[model samples]
Target chain A: MAEKDGDENKVAKQDQLPADKTQTVDSTSGTTQDASHEVQQELVPSDARELEVVDVREGAFGVRGTGDTSGYGGLTRPVMMPGAAQPPFGGWFDEVHDRLQTLTDSHDDRVIEKVVVDRGELTFFIRRHALLEVVTHLRNDDALRFEFCSSISGVHFPHESGRELHVVYHLLSMTHRRRIRLEVTCPDDDPHVPSVVSIYPTADWHERETWDFFGIQFDGHPALTRILMPDDWQGHPQRKDYPLGGIPVEYKGGTIPSPEHRRSYS
Target chain B: MTTVNDPYAGTTESTEGPVFTVTGQDWDSVDASVVEGDRIVVNMGPQHPSTHGVLRLVLEIDGETVRDARPGIGYLHTGIEKNMEFRTWTQGVTFCTRMDYVAPFSNEAAYVAAVEKLLEIEDQVPEKAKIIRVLMLELNRISSHLVCIATGGMEIGALTVMTCGFRDRELILDCFEMISGLRMNHAYFRPGGVAQDLPAGAIEKLHSTVRLLKERLPEYAALCNANPIFKGRLKGVGHLDLAGCLALGLSGPVLRATGYDWDLRRTQPYWGYETYDFDVVTWDEPDAYGRFRVRLEEMWQSLRIVEQATERLAVMEGEPVMVADKKIAWPAQLSVGADGQGNSAEHIRHIMGESMEALIHHFKIVTEGFRVPAGQAYAAIEAPRGEIGCHAVSDGGTRPYRVHFRDPSFVNLQGTSVMSEGGMLSDVIVAIASIDPVMGGVDR
Candidate 1:
């Protein structure tokens, strides 16, 4: 049956051939005839029904019947059933709560203050000094092998109390496909946190970027330097207090306004 | 030559010639052992090509080997995050698109999705708009990977491959130009819906181009993969295991190359990706070669998706690409003015003669954008390079309280040290290239 389909496909392709390729057409036709001859020798069942061949194009020498429609031309057909809906957020919240409880019981007391589960992810607020201990535990724990550090960013919250800046750590457990966030707060005067690069080497750049942008120093970092800005640049750019610069436009035909330019209402 | 008194040089007041007194009396006793050899400190960048865009690496070297590498960044800082805080919700799309110039569509999609979620308008977005966004993003992914392959080839001394890569990439860019007015920074994917429907002939052109790419991509694979020189340079170089990738928050091709089949499109399924039939290409090699194979295979998968999407688009013809909501989208056709700027005829007339209520609403929305309720949300999408996430905080304001982007290139670039530590200095180039860090994304 497959051999018969191949012969029909060859004939269909040969019908589309350009006029100059006569020799190639003859050779392809010969190959098809040879293939049919070989198939005739292998056939044994006399009771087999003859395979119907449909002439798709009359008088145009095109042979087209239902062949293997699973090849290149048949790829346009949608192949899979519709996917299931997204899992509810409540289950995700429960998992995060469970994980938080496990960490709180296992770790030192008075380190993790509260767990804020929002938008299907959990954020554990740890004291600045207890960050290293928590991260070490998270890394070494067999159940929570958060081997990846993903990102370390600092957010400045001048209006908040005990600490003005919140340093966030996004960690992932590749083994279980789970993610958790660890956040620690430090005062603006002394924005220092223990370096996690010693535990996960990937934190080197993330810490450096955090320091460069938010000015949150990561103590014990092997080589703390700016990873996005020049060393001589003044002020952390991402800090809320840092002033944004304006470029004076001179060659706009009509003067191009800077971002700070305000429109005058008539 | 005259002894010119340069005022700026050595002008600080001190006890004797700028604190030249020695504490240990080394000048009195001439000891050859006391004179230590000088160690040189050289600054590599802010301009060098290898440092990858305004990145300055301060190298402390003793002889040939580097003792320490201190990377300095922020030369390209444009304060985009802060600027987003000032802009209205719908206008934030333009600002986010500039964050990752290579894959602007992904940035736009992420920002739009976050806003849509905040507004609770996810279901309101038209299906045709979602399909259009998916098509644009997949095509953008192909172009972005082409750039990575081309630049990686150039960095590794295969100049011919760069030309081939860019030439193929141009075809995709041509399609982009036809759909979106601009080629690179297309703010075409707006909040609520796309800027407009797919232009005439775009679907047919995409169908043919995707078909051609499906046919021709194997040639690129055969050429680069079959070449022993290319393999020797790339294979086993810059190996970041799954542990390293997960630890560093690496996403996209880098994580997949380490054998993690975690694509947000497949796993999380945003923008109707759940309906698509495609595989997340992965490799267990965890090296530069593995990354290459993964990206190459992903391009093929993207083609498969584009083909399926184009076919689907053919059937869903004449559907509204924009949402019914007029608050977020302008209720007029945007056209290029004589000055080549976007202008709408209805917008001009509405401002002049519209009713007082309509004028006030337009004024407020145009000036302040839409308000997002006070809440915090984290939206993650699979960008061409990796996982691009936007963590937004809104305090019931017309603008975002805080918006942060988790750029994958920034996290992926950190693995460069792990890959290049004990290896030869030349391997650093190949390693960085294989990671395919975009400086715009990294710095942003």
Candidate 2:
């Protein structure tokens, strides 16, 4: 039986933008189209300068660079930042959200932040410290039995100051054939998050890997050593700030630029 | 042995001749002393001939029994995920294909599917492309499982099965080479569809390969099914029950062997797999033998799917293999010719000799990959080893913001310690063989 929680059980389905239309400028094409086009249709950009003026998203979005042989010169795509999804979460998403919200409210109040329903998948922005409690509840609650923690992946948002490192947990519910993502963030300088290995033992190696590539330390992981990078390697390679340069290979008449030297969309 | 000078032993003297403590007569005694007295730790290799590929295992052993087995990996870390961030979305396929090294098609399928989902173009991709994808995936499953069986057989000291498995696997690879012009790392699957349509005569070749596999698969069972030596080494060894599998996030045949019928192809049903008629094979023993049986039976199921796909493919000719939308698909059409494969001469002449717009369009799509709407999608396929997933995040950029793979080998390998901890030293190899951890997938 699901517990009765007053306001916590409310799945806040705010009126969201139409699910299909996202405002991403097609940098490849020179034209822009209004949202009236079919959901999948993309319009070419109108200006040729649009391909070179990528600096507009500087410091706010993905990397920007110059001098690339690849076609994208000035095009910049603006990614939507994570926010709360308006309610009537639709299909199984509303149920999963309410169950988690109620369960977390009864168990711990500091678990979730923003609930995003994008691409028909539900994502819970969880606080760094309450990961274990949240995961345990999600796995144990009969209605929300997300029995499998499918994977633990880390993403670094350089623009998101104070919370630059985000660790994502993709959980699967075999009983209901549902999937949910739990995202927790920590600052780049202090990237320490509580280990969810206690709830999902599968997170052991994955947590170690996150530590290896992104330098996010799992507070209670048994052995938080590097899994992919060598043990003595210094910097986490997957971080956005980490340079991509490698040993430059010599080809016939051309000096191939190392990734750091090559013009990338910084 | 001690009577000899032995100056080369007991020190780091690479400048001198290699260390040679063993004299002809002293070899047996040295082996005797280790087994009879002291506990010795064995380092299995960053290069062992059993063909797991660049994995090193340190087993602390007390005589013939292993006290503990610690895996030291990352010898094959290629920074593939990092490299993907630098390339356009389309080029990411080439890099991901090389990660698993074995199940190239599965990696491509998962990555492409994630990108398709992120771009919100899943429904728009041509139906012909989906059927071809299904065909390639099932065929890839057969080929990858064959390699697993081959290498697994060799690791367990069964030479005949290894030979038969590899020999049969070549039939599939040859078929792949004919279709995609490469056997192993076929970057055949692209974002919208495959890189190109199946080559001429590919259907007949695939049909022959399928028939040949049907005849050869049972020979493997006959050789190992009832053999006492084979069963003795595998049965009741490396026991990972359903609980162990679920706790560790293990999937594919390993979970199937534990009697959990959780194949993603059936449960989640990506790539129209739900429409296909096949049973999810499972076994209840939950041991090395169980995994072995599960893998064999799964191969049969893959073959069944492949046969069905080919039958449909035969009927569906002249259908577009790529998406209908011009922007999402690659610009140039490639054709196989007298010298291997390359861009079509006719398309090249058309762009160069006449149309300025066609040339510019080609330039833009080639240089900057198509932008995916900013969001994230986790697309998983039941790979030969287990659940291979691609978690793709696009920043509305031509390149991916981040791409992470839930490589099944990496997850299933957590069961290594659980399986080998209490077992005998020799069973360690059997356990590893059953888990079938591809080091490329593990270290990537």
Candidate 3:
């Protein structure tokens, strides 16, 4: 089991790199490709080229000698965590962003760190304190009316420092037929975000699930117990650092390494 | 006074009168006040067959009336969402399809839709592919509802209905096998389009099954709907009004049964569903019987959609099913060989002996898989149970960064406490059966 407390500064290292550098796929897949040595190529810069490769994890490929004969086994995949999007944010995204801005009066309203519009969906990376208020306004505002709390999902990014753990909320407006995502990050040390059960009772199990899998705690939840895994299980399985823990399987006088330890192109 | 399988006919069966420390029942820390006033606490199965796949209910009752109900879940957690992180984007479909074993197509659709949205190829997808997706999902809805009524009818002690329901469900499965080779868990819908076009005469096979289901629905209505015992058990047993449905995030039949027109297919139209003409079936009675009526009516609506899709697909033959872009698509060109469904022989020959570039293209796609740009998307669809949503995040790699399913079963499980609180213990089973939760979806 790793330390539940994640450092806040770890994720800041992502912004230091220049935004335009191209990332190589590398020989992530490691089997027969060793002889072929697939040449590195630059990804075509379309609308997606603007996103930066902020962080890369160690051991991008699986462990060696696990029978990973697929030449792509040495694949060390570098994750591209993109930077914040600029203004004029297109379509209904601009209206949602501008409307929420008027509702809040905080002088230091750095609630929205980045505005990312990708694949026709808008994601607001909000500060932890603004979650409850912003959600309440979204539900009550006649213009927004995001009455439905669709889902609350947990995502763990081990290499992205400080803001290592993310709790994502998918909110829907039945009246407007629009959906927006709200993501809040908490460091490993204080993985606590105020519970929104009072506002949206449906968030109860989702919060429990996020806690069960990512170990990010919701401070005021009624019952903060594990919902999916056994009550007394040890570590959060969904975290990237956690191993999948599968032994190689033997079949018909041949052996195949578990996906956990297989070599892949990185 | 009751000697009919009443093991405690002579002796009393109350907390104060006698103690029964059953191995499965556990309500140790309940309030002391409820312990008095002729109350009894019984723990009903993480393994009990009628509870619908490993769900355990802790019920506190006074005589036959339930005072409080607490649900204990997680017996069937396969950690499927976690396992998806290890596999490729296309392979994630296999794991996701297994989550809601009852409605595997809807599960597959939700996951793959998110992947397509991330790739930003949503609009460029071929028209015929969208039609096939609609065809498969509607067929899946019918089969899933059949299982629902079949098992629910059996749980309420109607053995004949169970036999009929499962028997009819097999026909739907037969059509499914014709399309994707597998009867259940068919990962038919790939990111860009379907894995391949419809097989020869597959539409005719679907037409026959659709005709059969349309005819047999009325027979089902007469046998189970009009039966007084069936009505007595389900009519007002698990009553949930519009308020309860809205607060609990309930959708599909349960919400529709409350006279709320909240079907996602009608309201949030996906995959050209808006182009089709169909009613969003609703019922005045929000109870177990109401859900049954809503399900039966929805089956007819599904039949209508399937009939329409089959007609469109007949004209759409020879059109492309996979995307024109080669980067996102798989290398295999699916075809029905003599033995079973497999890759095309012509395409195989071209790659092997005809062209070296074709062989290299095939190798690259097969080896690395496809890459999706860095972003996140949430896609939801109307499943048999309720609204099933998939939240997919890509790190611009061949594999998915993170994926989570907002299973309708998990959200609706909380309602067991609300509905069964003041109802009879027998009605508790009826109420749970009406919810029609698949534990595989709930725990995953």
List interface RMSDs for the candidates, in order.
10.5, 1.7, 1.5
Candidate 3 chain A: 10-residue stretch with minimal lDDT? A27-36
Kindly give the stretch of ten consecutive residues in candidate 2 chain B with the minimal lDDT sum. Answer: B15-24
Name model 2 segments beyond 4 Å from true.
Answer: A1-79, A106-109, A247-252, B1-39
**Cα distance off (Å), candidate 2, residue B241:** 0.2
For residues B1-444, what per-residue lDDT tens digits would candidate 1 score against the true structure?
233343212334433233211122333333345434543345766687765566555554556555555455566767677787666676778888888888889888888887777666788999988998999999999998888888888878788878988988888989998888878888888778888777678888998888778776787798898799999998998888877777666778888888779888987789899999999999989888889989999998888888878888888887887778877664555666787746576676776687677777777667656656545566678998888877676655567766878888777776766776556556667787888877777777
Under the 3 Å rule for N, CA and C atoms, how many clashes does model 2 have?
25
Q: What is candidate 2's lDDT per residue for A131-174, written digit by digit as tens?
A: 78888889999999998888998999875545668899999888
Fraction of native Cα contacts reproduced by each candidate = 0.42, 0.69, 0.66
**Candidate 3 DockQ category?**
medium
| Superposition error at B386 for model 1 (Å) | 1.7
* lDDT (10s digit) by residue, model 2, range B1-444: 134334323332333333432122343334353344455657777788753778777776787887778777788999899999989899999899988888889889999999999988899888878888888888888878878878888888999989998898888889888878899888888888888887778789878989989999999899988989999999999999988888899988999998889989999998789999899999999999998898888889989999988988888777788887778899887886689678999989999999999999898788766878777899988898889989998777788989999999999988888888767888888888888888888877
What TM-score does the predicted chain A of each candidate obtain versus native chain A? 0.58, 0.70, 0.76
Kindly indicate the candidate among 1 and 3 with the higher DockQ. 3
Q: TM-score, each model?
A: 0.75, 0.85, 0.87
Top candidate (TM-score): 3
Better of 1 and 2 by lDDT: 2
Give per-residue lDDT, candidate 1, residue A136: 82
**After superposition, which runs of candidate 3 have C-alpha atoms over 4 Å from their true positions?**
A1-11, A14-54, A57-78, B1-35
DockQ, structure candidate 2: 0.46
DockQ of 3: 0.51
